[model samples]
Target: MVTLVYLSVIILAWFATAANADIQVVCANKSVSITWEISADLVPYAARLFLGSCMPSHLNLLPSGKGEVQFNYGFENCKFKKQIKGKQMSYQNEITFRPYPKSKPAAFVYPIKCVYRSPANLNNQFLNPGSVSEGRGSLVFHMALLNEQLTGLATTNVIPLGSFMPIWAQVEQKSHQPLLLLMEECVAAHTPQLHSGSWVYPIINNKGCLLESKQGNSIFLPRYHSSALILYLQSFRLGHEGEVYIHCKLTAWDPDVLDESNKVCHYVKETERWSLLDDPFQSSICNCCDSTCKSRSKRQAEQESRGLRHNFVLGPLIVVEPDSPAK
Candidate 1:
């Protein structure tokens, strides 16, 4: 890597002259490299080549769920880099530039992005306290402990045989007793055609007495897990007013150091169903589009041919529930 960088320096120092040729490209995984590619005649001046690196543009993920991203390989200002050795001229036959920042760690920051919120958007199908039956659909929840000492990790709580499962699997096994559920809805004022900007976080709506569960406790008695959650959001919108869509977006990272090779690390498991902390398309996000960051015409057609991706899309995954719970 040092050799390529040094060689790039030589190319920039003595030989290359800034010409009319358009020059630029957006390399993946941060880091933009800009170098002037000169014809064979400028080889001697290429010895003076110097490289200038731009400060990387940093992007953060939104929400607090855990995730991991590894920077594989990337380079900026690639089209103009010259690779040669001892006057051994390689070809316009093909150009191969060295990939950089091989295996290095980044800071302890999470890859979180901010979700944009707009007051004018809402989902028409949603309802509230003033609406019809179903009691306006309230949510009551608690983290219950069956036999606090009878851990899901242990055998006494099971049927003698054992396999693999999460520490919270017991909560799922005994779906009765003290139950936990979270409810949320989105609303818009005049959500015309629901143009990708209609969504909201899961709001709280508790009813009756709430249930509570904690670790290292006894199972016979349940705690009064308390919350004053209700759906009196006058600003909330209805779901069915326009088109409704749910897309996924995750931002995860820890305090661990990231190396160049550290592409994915310390991912926060999608263990619990985390409520939405932010909506995906409240503002413009770079979902997909051909970028004009390059000067070459070859890449132009590639950017223009984007399909529906030109419009913002929630990440490709989401959990779906029915209008009413199972009858």
Candidate 2:
């Protein structure tokens, strides 16, 4: 009887271990990957497992009769939902398994989440309220060419013509009332410094209108916050070679107030109209985009003086023809 009891205990331990599922996850800048391991006892049910309505990208059968499945998908794909809370951006999804088609509920369910820092929160100095006004009472500003994932700076300076380029601009507004950032005007030139006779290309004109949107797929993406903006520009080659520089006039304004002179407007080809990114209901203010955007009156300028405006340069980006040889 004592020998039989020892054998029964061992059998129970093995069953417990086999019943538990092992899961691992890897989060990349643009995609998320999950690996689910199925024990030998549950290998038959592998077909029923799923990650947020997506099937396994790869499946392997182990020598030990166990099975492994991987799910890979982009953050915006696979029905993943996104949420922005304060300085954090989070993506959420779930893993589930159904034993039968007629089942009332999933037999297994596991919640999963991926979180990233907001583009405006990437700088550590912005976290400190006192540091924003430490010197000259000027706010800190940043602009960079982001990678395809929009998570960090681009690793390469080379860009293919007609490809979408992500440009991020942000301002530190710590300890101050909420503010909005706008690209009043932007231009592309061959040199970082503008001279009297330098040739230029207009990207954004008429105060805050994005002229490129009317010609190409370039437009402003949904803002993560009022203090930051992202421009998705369709790349273009200048002079057939060399480096290109982008010069932009950035303005910080009151969030509660958006007028024709202090707004970001992009043309919507589908609607055939200019739409204000901040407040679409106020898009009527964007009608002047096709003609001439009026300058701010003296009283309006004085009211906006509480905020700040500055010029920022981003560049040295090399745009090459698509048929050119790889660098």
Candidate 3:
């Protein structure tokens, strides 16, 4: 009877210690720091603790017999994953520890994340005079093909055929009212200039719907802001060789108003239905994705008069097969 009571006491103490573990994270412009305070009972297993495949950089034993571990890494290190969502860039990693040496899975896991404002300037060297449209008292629009991190333009023009390509488009609202950016239509072409003889593949069509998403994993990611959008397109081979260019018609519209003509939609494979990325409640606007999506005559004229629409091109991207050598 005494042995059973002692065993219960030990079990309760272990649970209490595990519940007291705490973690804190600090994010900076280019680096991140994570500090974890481990309970005294778990200090013996500290060697097995990891933060996203990275062992703690510094560990200190406290007077209370507890352990404090610190993890310091740059934004690009420690296997930290980056995500852009609603004007914020989030860096995510996990704190995990295995209670036993042979454990196949982590016995304890705590997710840690830090968020910062998305960089204002992506520093795209590809932006040319033609890419910007600034009518007197009108919004300025910019578009570029972003790198995998969404931090800047792709460093290289070569991409694996099946890999995801990131395209970012944003609007500099200036003094104008809040506006949302939308890709009305996008196409992949063999040449920078579109001629009658050019080979073209449609991506986003039917006004603002992502057509490739119906057949592929391509889709519009969540917006960094109402004024900024990112499209993750699965690369495809365009005629086996040279550079592929992406041409898109971008539109800026009132954020409060979303119509069949001014919205972003993508097909979700799981639900087998088209979904609106910005506002799902009004996803009914996406039903037109299957058929013709006509623009409101009056709205079209207004957009044209206000110079709220423009065309942008991004590319020279080379798509190669899985085993092909990098260019």
Candidate 4:
């Protein structure tokens, strides 16, 4: 009776130690890889792989020995390839992994480019906003700043004092991998005495304004698509009698960074900054207008005499003027 009881206990323990299937999906560069591992004891008699809604035989599982089995599939052989063959596909896709009756199906989402066009121009969308369009290689970027009246928006080189300005960005990507877009007010306020403290950092409305993410976290440009972001801005003082600059950059996401929350974007060569009060667009900002506006050619000479200078790179410059009193 004791021997029979011990044998029953051993049989239950062996069954509990049975093997299972594990799967992982990784997307990098312009490719997506699906990898899976199955323990020897749990090798399936038959297996099937489905990319999106299409189950191509090219990725069908093959017979394996009773040890460990592994398989990998590339994006070209997967759903994207089916897309090239004139098959109807959805913008959002999923990869399904299943092995006979022993395991449950595991699915991973895939992002596909649905529409590839420039977002509607914010200047045309907003009232009295300034607009400027810039490009590098195949990629293009644009920015628009709120005009003095606050009813419209456009791109401008000068930022006034004591005024509220709203800025918007537009980007078009021609790359295979997703691109990261970063817009920053690159003024260093801590710089000593040359009026560096006059400029205010932009407040981004990642929720309603930017189409990137609802959580205000990731700002990615989908492959072969264009996107836009709205920048929250306020200028308490003019950083200088000269121009302020706003910088825009695009890069590929880095996976090696341990902190997933940190926005780790590697800079590409196409980075550009929008200039304020730059050549052809010049203005003197003050709460009470005193000094006459100088041309771009003469402003440098005047700045030297005024003894006001900045040692940091000027980004998108906002010329702020005093607000009208409550009527």
Candidate 5:
């Protein structure tokens, strides 16, 4: 009877200790911050927590007698993967913290729910049947200019002329039904070179029509799969000046197929609208120029030469205690 009572006490103590260990995960910028608070009672037994595979890159542990510790892991180094949906980019990965040398039960493992949203001012279009689209499946389109240096950063509404602008277009299918698909892209003046799984054609039509490979329009997207087109172009035409409008149109069709029940016949026609300006595009900062471009440049140089520079040192300023020499 005494042994049974002692066993019950041990089981209860284990459960209590497990329940007290708390972990909190938060999205810090592009990285994830994982913090675990060890229960005071278990501090003596708690060792360093091991990340996945017990690799040195994932090892983060609390110092001796410390009750809490944090581990900040970059998205690339961690096991988590990134996903893109519409205008949002999210992380789909799990962080597992295991007790070193193995424990009675498993350690804490949880997924990090973090989403990075793109700017809301993108040129997005949703076409319905009879409007520009004729299909049972919902057709969606979006266009934006991505930063050359930082691919994840996007510029909206305006692009600079004469620059090799990187344009990103997204096409999503909301319906599960199979359908015959035809996709086409047309610029106002010169055709931009598209880079994707699909091909591009020189012939562009203002009226909505499916340009099949037989008919010369070679770009086609198969049904049931979403498509993303990365196009590049340098518009130096007559309308390449400041505040000039640049327009692009995308059209698709779903003609009647043999399998009527499996395929939903429809048509989609959408336009991606933006402007081409002479002012250079800058990500993470607003570009505000003076009335005259030449005047702004001259003033910018003068301000830089006369501006005061504040020399400052950035640091957390850590001090390490001296340890005794090992005998």
Candidate 6:
């Protein structure tokens, strides 16, 4: 009886400690914040953040703002493996947007393209082998949220932190392939040159089939176009050696817009929940300009030198603390 009681106590303690595992919250500005623990009892999705604990809670929330719109994203490093003996596996790729699209009782949706890979799982379609997708990959979906699924970008606030999502994937046999997905804020720039798995599309038809909105909101069209990326992983076997560029194109829509600045990276603190960083497309502050394009019409006038496309005037390399615990 004493042994049973001790075991129970130990189990309870283990559970308590497991909650709120350590996580590094990074902002685009290259700032680092630490999230030591999370709890399902108090916070629900705490367990899902840890790659070590592969429970059913498969969601990574990226908070946007309070409006309805079709968020296109994919994960970069999502892996799967059979436990000991091989077991059937299914997974979910979900996104938890912030402010919950505070609109009507409509449907909200986020799509995922599951590229199933086996020892021979070379296809980008469903993992079940026999499953058939349109082209290179199989696209699945998670929970449908509000009525914002079909609409274009609308009037919204900055997506708060704590938002998350999941990608649902399954396989007949047991094999684990880390996943890589991202959400494209726009769809127009998705081209062969755009190395990212997702895209940011221009005004198009009902691919996402966005919903219609009312007058209270602005025209809802974003001038500085933006897309979201759902990075399901940190790394993958690209079968090659190159950079995986995660680029976002901003469309400054206003005709009178002047300050077309760019932000390389920034820090996101735990306290600043809805932190906003600058866009990364502008020239790096580290590099300098030259007179190379002296005569080009679109080039910067000699008087206002914005040298080398990657002018080395950049700030010091961002230093981040190691995420893992004591080895």
Each candidate structure's TM-score, on Cα atoms with residue i matched to residue i, is 0.16, 0.60, 0.61, 0.29, 0.34, 0.15
Tens-place lDDT per residue, model 5, 208-272, is 12222223212222111224333343423333223222244432223221121111111111111
- Ten residues in a row with the worst lDDT in model 1? 207-216
Off by over 4 Å in 2: 1-136, 299-307, 323-327
Per-residue lDDT of model 1, residues 1-327, tens digit only = 897776566445422333342234333222333333334433333322222211222222324431111121122121112212222211111122222242532211111111212111111111222211111112211121122232222222221111211111111112223222212111223322344564543221111110110111101111111010111111112343322222111111111311111111110112111111111111011111112111213432342242100111211111123232321
Predictions in order: lDDT: 0.21, 0.76, 0.76, 0.35, 0.36, 0.22
User: Which has the better lDDT: candidate 2, or candidate 6?
Assistant: 2
lDDT of 4 by residue, 91-185 (tens): 32454433323255442223333222332343245422235555554555555665554345634545555444455554544562333333321
Candidate achieving the largest TM-score: 3
Candidate 3 lDDT: 0.76
Each candidate: how many clashes?
Answer: 53, 0, 1, 31, 6, 112
Candidate that beats the other on TM-score, 2 or 5, i.e. the better one? 2
What CA RMSD would you report for each candidate?
24.2, 11.8, 9.7, 18.4, 23.3, 23.4
Model 5 misplacement above 4 A: 1-15, 39-64, 81-92, 97-107, 115-144, 147-167, 172-327
Per-residue lDDT of model 3, residues 22-89, tens digit only: 77888776668888987676566577788775688898999999889898876444556655565686
Name the lDDT of candidate 2: 0.76
Residues forming the 10-long window of minimal summed lDDT in candidate 2: 127-136
TM-score of 2: 0.60
Q: Rank the candidates by TM-score, best first.
A: 3, 2, 5, 4, 1, 6
State residue 174's C-alpha deviation in candidate 6, in Å.
9.3
